[model samples]
Target chain A: MDIIIKDLCKSYGENTVLDSLNAVIGKGKITCLMGPSGEGKTTLMNILMGIEKADSGAVENMPQNKSAVFQEDRLCESFSAFTNVKIANDSLADDTIISHLEQVGLGDAVYQQVSTLSGGQKRRVALVRALLAEKDILFLDEPFKGLDEDTKKIVTGYLLNNTADTTVVMVTHDIDEASALGADVLYLKDGKITL
Target chain B: MKNKSKIEKTIAVAAALLLWQLASVIIGEEVLLVSPFKVLVRLSELIFEKEFYSAVAFSFIRITFGFVLAVAVGIIFATAAYRWHWAETMLWPYMSVIKATPVASFIILCLIWLNSSSLPVFISFLMALPIIYTNMLAGFKSTDTKLLQMADIFRFSFKKKLVYIYLPNIKPYFISACSVALGLTWKAGIAAEIIGIPDGSMGEMLYNAKLYLATADLFSWTVTIVCVSILFDKLFMKLINTMFKRLEDL
Candidate 1:
């Protein structure tokens, strides 16, 4: 079933973020949300993920099981990459997590804690976590922010491959990323969908 | 991480000991404070006595038992309180009283209600419980919500979540609580022993020293307690760091 949002409005004190936002997310498709800074892209994702609530809105058919790559890496800093993925799905064997880490160009860092890994490696770990999780829907907020060109291609391909059958909503400022991920772009402006 | 030799540190400590002996000579009285050399001699003498071993064994067993019990109970209550707001609210006043009340008062009260031999154990438990609970509670509260949400989405088992998420988050706090409470247990345990004057215990020795005005004995015993406390702290910290490293490797 497709997710439908109608007449969604949200505000933080005096600042209006989303106003009467209406959109439809087709089931089993990648939708990339594109906006300038402070365009409420993250707020919308948070609302969809049920971490935050919109002030006034109606959302239909949001999947019960959801996963996300939050704005922060959000990986447990003291735990290894394998452990981070295992935290999301412990029934998974060590080899399965290592394979996923291998895909993200983090094969070497898999046995080391997220704290000791470099920035791009940590982001890949978080991405692998959300991708491997058994969720009906996936939300990614700038999930590929820090990777170099080569690593980005590698990880983006892995993300696309894993999320083929799941509905994905990604927030990014980069049009190239939206294009590379083959996501349907929704242009956002001041509290409204402009295109 | 450091390449410095352990022998250098040992030599430095020896130098400090020699300085202490010089100070003892200058003072010309053991009453004020016994030199490190004199304390070592006394400790060696005490070590050879059968009664001293029994005293050490008794004190060690009771205090350790109390510490272990406190850790178990504290973790349970702290986790419960973390999960339920009502439990935390109910425990607030109890923790406050435990933190604010004087250790001596608790020892005296326990002396009246408990067997004299059990007093140190009871006091150690009382002193340790609140520290462990409060620190672990703070650690639990500060755990990353994002990681929890991830675990929820993934349907990780309780055992997996504990090993991966909760353990890593609570580790530093657990180590810190252990360090703080270990010293406190020794201090409070000995204090209780002195008041209750349990036979074949360090407290009894301290009590005897007081009665005979053997200030050197008092100073020597005090030094022993300090040394033991430091040794325990270092060992505990080392054990925890190794565990964390292993977890990181996992």
Candidate 2:
């Protein structure tokens, strides 16, 4: 089922972030939300993911099982990369988690603490954690922000392969990322979705 | 740099000891201030007595038990207060009273209610509770909201959330609380014992030494208490660190 947002509104004191916004996030497809800074792209995602309450809005068909790579890595810094991913879904086999980390070029650092990993490496760990979780929808907030070009290509490929049949709402400023993922591009401007 | 600091600490200790020796010699009265050498000799003699072992064991068990009990109860109370505002409100007055009231007052009041033998245990627990509760509560409040939101999205179970998020976040606070509470508990515990004069206790030994005006024995027992307290503090901290290390590794 698709997630439909109707008349979504959010405000902080006198500043309004999302005002009367409406959009449909398609089920089992990739959707990229793009916007200038402070346009409430993240606010929209947060509302849809039920992390934030909209001032006035209705979000329909919100998935019961959802996963997210938040704007920050939000990982357990003392835990290994493998443990961080494994914690998302304990039912997943050890080998499956190892293979996913290996795909992202983190096989050697799987057992190393996330604090020891570089920014790009931490991002990959967060991405892998979200991808491996048992969820109907995946939310990626600037998931590829810190990756180098070559690593980005590998990570994007891994994301595409894993999310082929999963609903994905990605927030990114890079249009090339949207095009590479073949996502339905939606521009968030003035708290409303366009195109 | 590390070796330099070690040498510095050694020098400071030696200078302090020399000053103590000089003061004792100038005083020249064992009844007033026993020299360090005389105190050491008294300690060596006390160790040969079976009563010394019993007294050490008696005080050690009660004080340590009190501290351990306080830690467990404090953590539980802190977690409760964290989860529920009502719990915090209910506990506020008690914690404040415990923090503000004099230890002697509590000891005297508790003497009217509890057995003398249990006095140290109660007093230590009372003294340590507020420190642990306040520090652990601060820790809980300081947990990252971002990680908690992530845990929610991932639908982490309570057990998983505790191990992966809460425990690690509260570790530094827990260690800190333990460090402060350990010293406070030992001091308060022994003070309680001295007031109550429980049989077969280090406090009773100290009381007897005072009664006989054996200043050397008094100094020796004082040193023993300091040694035991420091030893326990170090071992407990080591255990806590190892436990956290194992948790992180897992």
Candidate 3:
């Protein structure tokens, strides 16, 4: 189902972030929202993810089940990567998690606690967690922040392959990221989408 | 490595004991204080006495029961307060009263209201509950919101969320609460017993020594209580540490 957001309005105590924004995200396709920093990209993503409530707007056909790579990694640092993925999965085999990690080049560190992994490794773990989750929608918020160019290519390839045919909304500042993922880009400005 | 450290600690303690004996000999007054050697002799003699064992057992059981009860109730109340603002406001004045009011006053009032045997238990519980509740709630509140958001999005089960996320963050707070409350419970429990004068309790032994002007016995029993309190703290900490280490491994 297409996610139809209409007349979206939001404000934070005299600072308006979004105003009468409207967009339609196609079903089972990657939609990348790109804007300058502080252009309400993250805010819009948060509203769509149901983490932040829109002040006066309506979101239609949002999936009941969603998974995300938040602005932060948001991993359980004390637990192993395997445990984090397992916690999100419902009856998924352990081998499924291992395969996703291997595809993302995280196989060597899958058994290590997230606290012991490097920043890029942790980001990949977070990506694997989102991809492996049983969800109809996936959101990524600048998931490539700490990754180098080569690792980013490998992770982006894995993300695209895993999330293919799954409805995805990603927010990023990099055009290369949008191009690499073959996403339809929506330029966000003054809280409204300009496709 | 562990055994070597333990032996070194034992030698250090022995050296301290010798210094204590030397200081006591130079002072030469039993009422002022007894030497460590004398206290050890008294401790050995008391260990053979049935009354000593009974007193120790009685106090240990009651105080530990009170502590466990307090921990359970504190977590429940703290969770309730976390969920409802009104519950937090309502509990403030009562916790404040408990914190500010003296243990002796509570013991005397409780003596009128409860059986002599139960006074220590009641006092210990009253002393321990508020601190644990406050610390646990603080820990719960400090949990990362972003992580909770991720958990929500992924539809993690309540049990999994608690075990994987909450437990790791809440542990330090729980440990701190236990360490602080354990000592306070012991102090309040024995103080209550002394006021209530319960039979078959360490408090009774101390009181009897006081009445007869047996300063040596008083010091000996006081030392025994100190030893027991330290043992309880060390043993409780060891058990909790081992559990958390295993949990982290899992």
Candidate 4:
């Protein structure tokens, strides 16, 4: 089922983040939201992911089972990359998790603590965690923010291969990245979608 | 550099012992200040005594039991307080009272209600409760909201959330609280035992030493207490770290 945002409004005190926004997020397809900073791209995704509430609007058909790669890595620092990914879905086979980590070029660092990993490596761990999780919708908030172009391409390819049938709502500033994922781009400006 | 620091620590301890010996010599009275040599001899003698093991065991068991109980209760109370504002409000005054009251006063007051054998357990629990509760509460409150939100999005069960997110996040705080509380529980528990004069306990040995003006015995018992306390603290902290390490591995 498609997620329908109807007149979604949110504000922190006087500064409105989402101003009566409305959009349709199609099921089983990638929808990339693009915008300049502070345009409520994250707020929209947060609302859709049920991390935040829209003050006076409704989000219809938001999937109960969802996964996200937050702007921050948010990986448990003391845990290894393999452990971080496995934490999302404990029932996943050890070989499958290791294969996913290897695909993202983390095979050598799979058992090293996330705290010791570089920024880009940590981002991949977060992405892997999100992908491994059982979910109907996947949210990626600038998931590839810290990666270099070469690494981002490989990671994005991995993401595309894994999430072919999963609904994905991604927020990014890079137009090329959105296009690379074959996403339907929606430009967010002043808290409204301008697709 | 680590070896250098170890040498420095050894030198410092030797200097302190030398100073203590000098003080003992200047006093010219064993009752006033027992020499390190005398204390060591007394410790060796005490070790040969049959009652020594029983006394040590008695105090160790009661104190450790109290500490373990406090740890369990403190975690539960902290979780409850974190989940409910009313629980926090209701617990505030009791925690405050426990923090503010003197160990001696609690020991005396508790003597009226509890038997001599149980005084140390109750006193140790009382003394350690507030520290564990406060630190664990802070830990629970300081848990990363971003990680929690991530957990939420991943549809994590309560057990998974606890093991992966909450426990790891609170590891430092829990360890620190235990470190502080372990030392305090020993001190308070011994003080209670001293007052209550529990038979077959370290406190009774100390009391007897004091009453007979056996300065060497007193110093030896004090040294034993210090050694036991340090040993338990290190062992407990190692256990906690190992447990956390295993959890992280999972």
The root-mean-square deviation over C-alpha atoms between each candidate and the true structure, in angstroms, is: 2.6, 1.3, 1.8, 1.5
Give the per-residue lDDT digits (tens) of candidate 4, residues A133-157. 8889999999889999999989989
Better of 2 and 3 by DockQ: 2
lDDT of each: 0.86, 0.93, 0.90, 0.92
Calculate each model's fnat, 2 decimals.
Answer: 0.76, 0.96, 0.92, 0.88
What is candidate 2's CA lDDT for residue B191?
Answer: 90
Best of the candidates, TM-score: 2
lDDT of 1 by residue, A21-131 (tens): 999988999998888999899999888888788999889999998888999887778777887887776568888889989988887888886799999888999899888
lDDT score of residue B249 within candidate 1: 66
lDDT string, candidate 2, B32-148, tens digits: 988888988999999999998899999999999999999999999999999999999999999999999999999999899999999999998999899999999999999999899
Instruction: Report residue B91 deviation for candidate 3 (angstroms).
Output: 1.3
TM-score of 1: 0.90
Which stretches of candidate 3 lie above 4 Å from their native place? B1-15
Model 4, B63-111: lDDT tens digits are: 9999999999999999999999899999999999999998888999899
lDDT (10s digit) by residue, model 3, range B1-250: 9999999999999998889888889999876767887777888899899999999999999998999899999999888887899998999998899989988889989999999999888999999998899999998899998888888888888887888888899899999999999999999998888779999999999999888877778878998998999999999989989998887776
DockQ of each: 0.61, 0.89, 0.84, 0.81
Clashing pairs in 1: none
lDDT of 1 by residue, B74-141 (tens): 99999999999999999999989989999999998998899999998899999999999999999999
Docking class of 3: high
Fnat computed for model 3: 0.92
Docking quality tier of candidate 1?
medium
Predicted candidate 2: interface RMSD? 0.8
